[model samples]
Target: MSGYCGASALNRFVNDLLFFRNRLPLHVAEFSSYGGDNFDEAVQYLELWIRYSLSCPVAKLSVTSHDKYQRWLLPKGLITSEHLTALQLTRVKTQDDLDFSSCVSLKHLKMTDCGIYCDRIMSPSLKRLMIAQCHFIGYARTQIYASNLILLLLVDCMGMTPLLVSMPYLVEAFIRLGYCNDFCKHSYEIGDCGDESCWGCQFYEDNYGNNNCILLHGLSSCTNLELTAATAPFIFRKDLTRCPVFSKLKTLLLNEWCITNNLGALICFLQHSPVLEKLIIQFEPPEIHERLVEIGGSYDLRKQSLVLKDLNVEVRCDDGDERVHKVLDVLGSYGLSPEKFKIQRPPKLTRARFDDTWTSGSFSFEQEI
Candidate 1:
């Protein structure tokens, strides 16, 4: 189980499982492979084990492949399993036809450091889904349709950001769009960069013109949400133009991406969320130096109304820093009193100059106000 076993040993193990008459109801089955000299043989053994485990109707299944260079293509039977309630995978590659709709009993699913070569993930019984550090290996944007999902964590994933279908039952979601996203580097600030040949630009225009709510629409039902993006990802800013009202949202957290466009995106969310109570903004200092893009003309804060019970601003800079004051000025413009919000700075790193490389701690409002 730790390392590669000889071919005879592997065959004997598989033969034992295959011929065993009294296969007890399998509650959990886990397999980890370090890989070996023969890749095809290893795959064959893996397939046999997976087939045996599925035949046993495993309730929870986990598979981890240590080989970074080569990944096992998940068996089609695993996706259609009815007894699997919890499934975890790492370094596994999924095919383009990967669909979880057939998994009627599946609830909790997690994938890490895996290769996702699929265009869509449709499931009905899934409740909690987490996909972190996974590489989405395709040119088209991946679409996720988990209508019954409650908790979602799609963090630090590399590739084009996946389009989320409506999740009406969702309660909390943590989506962190990394720098490697498709349009993260492209500037949609000046309205589409009219390059017909550029795929990013063309995709941006197609989505914008069609008023596609790529992410926000699916997350509209969540009560607590954290949306963090590196530097300047255009998805969040672009969605703000046709922003959905967060009717159920109470606690919301955002990073520098919201304020990159002259606080227009921030103000847009404020106007949309009528019931939002707590707002946390993790201020990134380096964004202050970047040139701001103009989105949907200038924001008129006076026309909008915001009533928040709490607002916490976590910044790496000192309290007297201009960056902090600039944020305060924007909040003040929206009729937010000083007592409603507090400036939070980490104790050990107070007053330390931070660059684009600095990453803040977990997004929480637990710090002393």
Candidate 2:
């Protein structure tokens, strides 16, 4: 709110807040804080106003919270503990920013950049739990069975120990390794822990450590994923188990910019999907932009079940890079024949380049690799 922290923002802001279940939506979408330290105060004001607006409300329940953690907490101090439905507690520094105990109706929950602990399990209706950059002390344990549960995202949660999650209904789960505060980037808590043991833990593990083989096999019910591997993970092999949904992943992106999967994993990925239609490989070479135009161009997409008509490979290049000749040569060497495969040169990196919609949707050679 500092950018528009004035009273004017609050004038119309009062109506912007929405609540569900017994919980309230505090931080709409942002998962981290930039400059504001006291946005909680503004949030608190909104909640009180929402309560007042409830009396006149007839059909629609337009509940509100001013984002005040303590003010909303009662002698019982269990705000989210009742009537609460959807909770959006993002970038909140305070523990009490969300009264979890009072949020009895919570179904969709999102949180980041705060210390969270749940000694007792929460709402049975709670389905979606999106959290990141937060720590939970006392080893909080809550046994909740959400058959309607959909998404559970935990990023940079360096604290959580990998637990055998039992959410069979979970549809989408996204996790990445990096500094918790930044959300998109991960620096090494144990950056080079990947001697051999720490493989899947960072990207596939429930927590932020290298995952075990068991965890790799348990995707719960997650169908859609957007995982960024800070390192090569080998906790689970494709031969060990078959993930039909993931193997034929509708949309997939592998950012080996900082780390590259082993040759085995890379080859397995090439052959893993029979249904993979779009693939984006972000090749980030440290000192030089090593244009891997050769490898990606000449891939055996057919062996992986991706026929020429079904495959679209995009080898992203940093600007000012020269043409790639060998990478394409390599694909043609093996079974990933270069039938109709072209060095897809994407248009100049624009806002469009950032979109997962188009890049992951179409299979066209708009430019060179």
Candidate 3:
């Protein structure tokens, strides 16, 4: 398997997985984007990979097709439209949709900037999902319902939440809501075009990062959850739940400044997610609040059920008294031995921003917190 014949043989090996796969595995699985006078040749390549490579034990899908990349621009029937001008996509074809239902054994799916969740798709074997800057994602029933699935990320999908897919048993989910201020134009461009048919900014905005809000609604259902956000404003209302859930969660991350009574949120967290063991509190510069030592001597967590094992902290500067000891007092009260603490004053903050009206002094902690 050397040149073009090697590619062809690999394609054949991948196209029909039932044809004795698990031999020497073809390392890279790619979706060709060559939209020429002869488009069938490319579809043959995609169909082969989607059909074959996915059948193995350690399947890898790095979807970068002209179709997959631009799947966001194509509507229900317009992907195959004969009228070329009617579409905003660069490649036009009769290629059938590529899904992962057959790839139930897949462990890794990397679709960066793709048109995913367009159908009732699921990857029961998926363990990793990485999606970057993509377009419209049609709401599939459940793109990932696998119990084995872990680690999933969606970045820069400016306009839509193409990620409403729910996983009942995920252990780690890291999501950043919203996008760069520059990409805001892309959101407005793909807006709903039907004023007479009922469409507006909000309707169209429902497509990208806005849809990441789906994670909030799906959180209570995720008992085995450990998630981190770069300061998302999705403060779930009281009716959402009195206590936050993460019963099996062991590690929590904070990339920027985190402000609260610190204890109030902890009260709610311990009230529900009792099994938590490791808590990481990271702070950015200027507001690192210094590091908490044995502040206020010690304070109790109020709820006595929490048994946290570790508190690994990274602070930007060693400056303020308000920052350090307050948190230490909170942990000391929780019965955490001093030897279990892993604290680092980084002297600099990571490039992240957080907005806590309670912490920023716009509102008083006694009032809001």
Candidate 4:
């Protein structure tokens, strides 16, 4: 029942359910706050249901707090359940005493707007983890060790310290990390002090030396990778010391933000991936492109022969410029047919942009008239 229950009635219900919960064949139990007057009563009943589910053979447990004012603190004992395979929590907050290492059977974990205070999450059986709009609680860096993980998605998460991951079987990953207000000081230091004729921003230089080394190592096995504009700067700002090999990667999607700003990272990917087939780069906002031109590249990826086949480049420019042609020439040097590399200018002057698709087949290179 997803309706309101009085305090006394809820207590009685839990007492009654306790007698037969062991005998009932419970596979899934979902609880959502529909409507209720007594808040404590509702919380007690929800806690009781969670406890019951943890004690049985329940495979899935989902709890949602649709009301903005309603936030639930996840019970610490919830992770101790040996049978839970899937857990979905919305608007949930975790405390320091929580331990997720005991969730050995957990395969899928989805958290939205959650505050994670734990320092480490070690799950051997976890396969998919999706976290969106969530924030870390303390100053500790988040460490995750999942050997069998296949898919990982992190979107718009904030307050993230250095992240360390060790996943050997990861196949598909999408990481979109946007600028948060908390890192404003670091941004100002880099933007104001490090200008034209400056060596570089010390703040970003320190972050590069720490963040990407381990994170990129974890993502080396992905077959399809998408890095939005937000996470592009991490690679753009640094000259990688040790690059990971993307042996299985076939498809890669990059925002024009990365190409315009951190072309070296793109070059690094090309050098590492031995069998990359498709590359799609989307046009970013004008402001972002301008910033890249200002302080983007002082260093570039080392030249190496690559096995890339298909290239799709999207650009926002007034007309075909020398800079754009230079990029095409670079790719051509890598063995892509310049004839098949045709740029399609928009019919009307709507935006400063064009799309070019290059397929590695025997075709004539057509030039713009």
Point to the candidate with the largest lDDT. Answer: 1
- Model 4 scores a C-alpha lDDT of 0.59
Which regions of candidate 4 are displaced past 4 Å?
Answer: 1-22, 34-42, 97-99, 180-214, 235-242, 285-297, 303-329, 339-369
Per-candidate TM-scores read 0.83, 0.50, 0.50, 0.72
Sliding window of 10 residues with minimal summed lDDT for model 1? 351-360
Q: Write the per-residue lDDT of candidate 4 for residues 1-369, one digit (tens) a residue.
A: 454354556456666866765657668877664445655555656676777777776888888654566567777666667788888887777765444567788888888887776766567888887777777743445666677988877667666443546677997776666653223223322133444433323333433323345357777888877665464354322323356778888777665544543355566667877777666554434454533432423334555656445654433343544446655766776677765455544223232111122121201111221
User: How accurate locally is residue 46 in candidate 3, as Cα lDDT from 0 to 100?
Assistant: 59
The order of the candidates by lDDT, greatest first, is 1, 4, 3, 2
TM-score between model 2 and native: 0.50
TM-score of 3: 0.50
Candidate lDDT scores, in order, read: 0.70, 0.40, 0.40, 0.59
The TM-score-based order of candidates, best leading, equals: 1, 4, 3, 2
Candidate 1 scores a C-alpha RMSD against the true structure in Å of 5.7
Tens digits of per-residue lDDT for model 2 on 176-238?
Answer: 544322111222221223434443323433242123222323343444544444433222222
Q: Candidate 4, which ten residues in sequence have the lowest lDDT sum?
A: 358-367
- Steric overlap count per candidate: 0, 46, 12, 3
Cα lDDT, model 3, residue 235: 24
- Candidate 1 residues lying further than 4 Å off, grouped into runs, are 3-22, 184-186, 205-211, 284-321, 346-369
